[model samples]
Target: MSVFAGHRLTCIRGQRVVFRDLSFEVNAGGLLLLVGANGSGKTSLLRLMAGLLAPAAGVICWDGDDVRRDAETFRGVMRYVGHLDAVKPALTVAEHLRFWAALQIAPGSPAQPEVTTALEAFGIAHLAELPGRFLSAGQRRRLALARLLLVPARLWLLDEPRTALDTAAVARLDAAIADHRRTGGVVVLSSHAGERPPEATVLNLDDFAAAATEAWGWREAW
Candidate 1:
């Protein structure tokens, strides 16, 4: 079993201490949900995990090996879905998936079937020919979520994935997450929704706020 862990992580963004001394671990088939008020370190922590930002202290390790040692390799095994949708105005829905499938899937393998499957998973198969600009907010969000199914990755880092999703779309997302976890995939997401994947471990950034205040004399509230 693989383990992804953060030990004593301290995040400082633009001279503001977001959180400090935060530690957590997720084993294979595990789910970790980050919850906190806006301005908490949830997104920051997710970005750190995705190797987009460096931790001011501590390290992120996969099976005891520091991710920084080989970030490009580490990134290949993970997928990150942030607040922004990656949709392009001119690309049709299928084209968008094909673009990503090309990058994530192996060379020579046909990507159409996988793209079709992903579109169906998020109930967007009908929109496959539609341009990204024509889709609704909910549809765009579903398309973003569908990318998860197009290729296999061990870790999924999502930042507020439920943002524009309807109840049904959210259910699809929950199901997708469940399926991923069943396959030993690790998921870390920040959400404000009442419903979440079952048996998820919670990491509330509120718990780390005090440490940041005390350690850095940061007084402005998040």
Candidate 2:
């Protein structure tokens, strides 16, 4: 029963507090859906879980060990896909995946098969020989999502992953997520598109924002 948990997390950017006392937990083979309005700290929360941004207060733990203490190991077992599509205009789709695989996969493993499988999973196999510069917005997004299959990570942190994806691509993504969970992987995602994964636990950032403001006895002026 591997568990990834966050306790009483408080996120602050510069002088403003984004969310406070937020907590969540996801067990192996579980999915968490982050729901909230824009600027409600969904992205910040994902970044916090990914260790890209340290929490102002609280801890994120993996199987009862504090992630901050073994940041490298925690990072190695998780992948964070952010809002931007990280594609290089100069590299063909296959090249880009191969480059990432070289960094993520074990030295002696056959990464090419994994690369092709990932592209195929995302329905982007046909785009493998195409330069990133020529890809449409949907194609580029699929290319970014395909990285999830390139490596075996325990946890996935995705921010707005469905953006720019068509119906078919979205279906492929949902299927990929389901398969990952079946293999004891965990996923935490934010989507404004209102698409929900089956049996996902929902956490609303707006609740945290309201609670934090009331706890502090302050309100922002409009």
Candidate 3:
């Protein structure tokens, strides 16, 4: 089981600062929710945690190792799912999953059985042979999520994962997340929707409104 720790995180986008001195820790088997309004730096915070963006100040440590110092090593233990589905329109559902799975020397392969299981779990089994372009928005989202089952990483960084999912699909997503937590996997997600797994800790980005307001000067503009 691995753990992620961020201390005094500070991020800047151009002249505007997103956060300052923000810190949090998430261990394996835990879930953390990042909540905030639009343009409140929720995505920025997640990117920082995923090591896609560098913090202007402070450090992100994974299992006591500085992620910035060794990003590849840190990324090896983590999986990041952004708001956009990284699926190729030319590929079928199974092909998409297999492609991503082949890139990582991980525990599971996104072969037919596992792909079918994941698709069935998300109620997208019927779309297995369909190309990414042929699926609906919701179906594409499910296909993207199916990749998670194929690649078992200790930490998961999800940004609005429930987008475009139906009620049943949402329930399935919640169940999958719960199961991941039970298996000692860590998750940190940012979402405007109130849907969250049971017993998950909440971190409202509004708590840093003062910093955001001060950094962006929205008070004076509005």
Candidate 4:
């Protein structure tokens, strides 16, 4: 089983100390949900796990090996979905998914079938021919979430994954997450929604903010 852990993680963005000495762990088949007010380091924490940012102190490890030693290799096993949608304006829905799917294919990966399956998973198969410019906010978000199904990755780091998703779309997202977990995939996501994947473990960054020192003029941890 794979284990992803942050030991004594202290994150400082700019001059502000977002959080400090935070430690957490996620194993295969588990879900870790990060919840907090703005600037409480939810996105920052996710970025760290995604290997996009390094901690000022402590270490991030995978199965006891330092991720920094080989961040590229570590990222190969992880998928990061940030706040911004990287969809292209000119690409049709099918083309968009195909582009991302092609990027992750190994030497012998069956590429075409994966793209078709991913769109169907998000219920966007009907929109396959529509260009990105024609989709609604909810549809775009659904497309972004569908990207997760395009390739096999053990860790999924999502930032506010429920944003702009309709009720039905959110249900699809939940189902996709459940399927991933069943396959020993670990997930860490930040969300404000009341409904979440069943059995997900919570890590409220709000609890960490309350324990922070106010001397630094951090002005209410965001």
How accurate locally is residue 158 in candidate 2, as Cα lDDT from 0 to 100? 90
Q: Which digits, one per residue and each the tens of the lDDT, describe model 3 over residues 1-222?
A: 348888888788876886678888887788889998887788999999988899888998888888889777677678888888987889898888777777776444323436667778788878778888888888888887887776677788889998898888888988888889999888998899877667777887766644534655554677
Residue-level lDDT for 105 in candidate 2 = 44
What TM-score, computed on C-alpha atoms, does each candidate reach? 0.90, 0.91, 0.88, 0.90
Better of 2 and 3 by lDDT: 2
Evaluation by TM-score, superior candidate among 1 and 4? 1
**Cα RMSD (Å) per model?**
3.5, 3.4, 3.8, 3.5
Pairs of residues clashing in candidate 4: 38-222, 39-222, 40-222
In order, the Cα lDDT scores of the candidates are 0.87, 0.87, 0.80, 0.83
Q: After superposition, how far is residue 187 of candidate 4 from its true place, in Å?
A: 0.7
- lDDT of candidate 4 over 88-136, digit per residue (tens): 7789988888788777745444545477788889999999999899999
- The residue-by-residue lDDT of candidate 1 on 21-47, one tens digit each, is 999999999999999988888999999
| Residue pairs of candidate 3 with colliding backbone atoms | none
Q: Please give the TM-score that candidate 2 achieves against the real structure.
A: 0.91
User: Residue 85 lDDT in model 1?
Assistant: 90
- Measured by TM-score, how close is model 1 to the native structure? 0.90
User: Distance (Å) between predicted and true CA of 16, model 3?
Assistant: 0.6
The TM-score, computed over Cα atoms with residue i paired to residue i, of candidate 3 is 0.88
Worst 10 residues of 4 by lDDT: 210-219
Alpha-carbon deviation at 216 in model 4, angstroms: 6.4
The per-prediction tally of clashing pairs is 0, 0, 0, 3
User: Residue 87 deviation, candidate 4, in Å?
Assistant: 1.1
